[model samples]
Target: MQTILIIEDEKDLAELVAFNLEREGFRVMTAHDGLTGLDQASRIKPDLVILDLMLPGLLGTEVCKTMKRNEKTAAIPVLMLTAKGEEIDKVVGFEVGAEDYVVKPFSTRELILRVRALLRRAATPPSPGSVVKVGPLTLDVERHSVAIDGAEVSFTSTEFKLLHILVQRQGRLQSREVLLRDVWGYAFVEDSRTVDTHITRLRGKMGAAGELIRTVRGFGYKIEL
Candidate 1:
């Protein structure tokens, strides 16, 4: 069974989510504060984490950043929960390495669907020993690792998947909707800005090699040599 960690300060809500997830046949763990959540994440290394944007001991963003920095836990997918639905808030959450975001007042069914989608995406098998090289970028798809000009770089699971798709379809224009569906496993596209935020971060992480990913102007993105 896949383990899911819920790092939410609201005891009632956290328990509610845990209950539903358990009913869905997942092993659930809960933490009421960000620091405890981080500790538990490092210790348990859950398959997926449901993190709240606001927490008492530490902010959820900090918890995610720390996890992304740690090699052991960096690849775990994080689904952020927040009451704020502003675009900037979502951008911040994505920037901090969250693989998905859910605004509060959301239905239990919606959350569950998202949870399942993230898990499915994370569980997708990569082609064995498949490596793609474009300019100064090299991606080992099977190992889920990236190297730029012989120097290794760390990428969150979501970022790596997004990059993998772009490189796989290199020279082909991918619309925001297509990217959201393919990379994120979202059946319906809510906001395409999520794709934008991740693309921006992907570029920054790639440094100059980021130029290999080109913007199609008012459309989406593509990879080119």
Candidate 2:
């Protein structure tokens, strides 16, 4: 059974979510504080994490960032769970390496669906063409590594997938909706800013090679050699 770790302070809510997830055939673990959650995540290395933004010991963003920095846990998917619905909050979550965001008062069904989608995406294998190169950027699909100008650069799984798609399609424009559905596995496009925030972060990490990913103004993004 796939393991899912839920880092939430609300005891009742945590139990409720755990129960539902267990019913859906997943092994669930819960932590009430950010520090404990981070520790458990490192030790057990759950397949996915459902993290709350507000916690007693540490902020969720810090936890996510630390996980992304650790080679052992960097590839695990994180789904941010919080009451905040502001655009800035979503951007912050994505910037910290969260693969998906779910606002409070969310439907149990929808949250479960999101969890399944994340798991599916994580389990997906690299395409038949394992290595893709464009200009100064080189991506090893099997190794899940990227290098620019012969120097390695770290990228979260989400960012890697997005960059891989853009590079594979080279000069084609990818609309935000298409990217959301393809990279994120979102059946419906809720917000386009998710795509924009990831693009900004992706560029920053790529340094000079970042320029290869060009914005198409009110449309989407495309990578050009």
lDDT of each: 0.91, 0.92
lDDT string, candidate 2, 65-140, tens digits: 9999898998899999999988889888987889999999998998998899899999998887587889899999
Quote each prediction's TM-score: 0.87, 0.88
Candidate 1's displacement at residue 69, Å, is: 3.3
- Candidate 2 off by > 4 Å: none
The list of candidate 1 runs beyond 4 A from truth reads: none
Predicted model with the maximum TM-score: 2
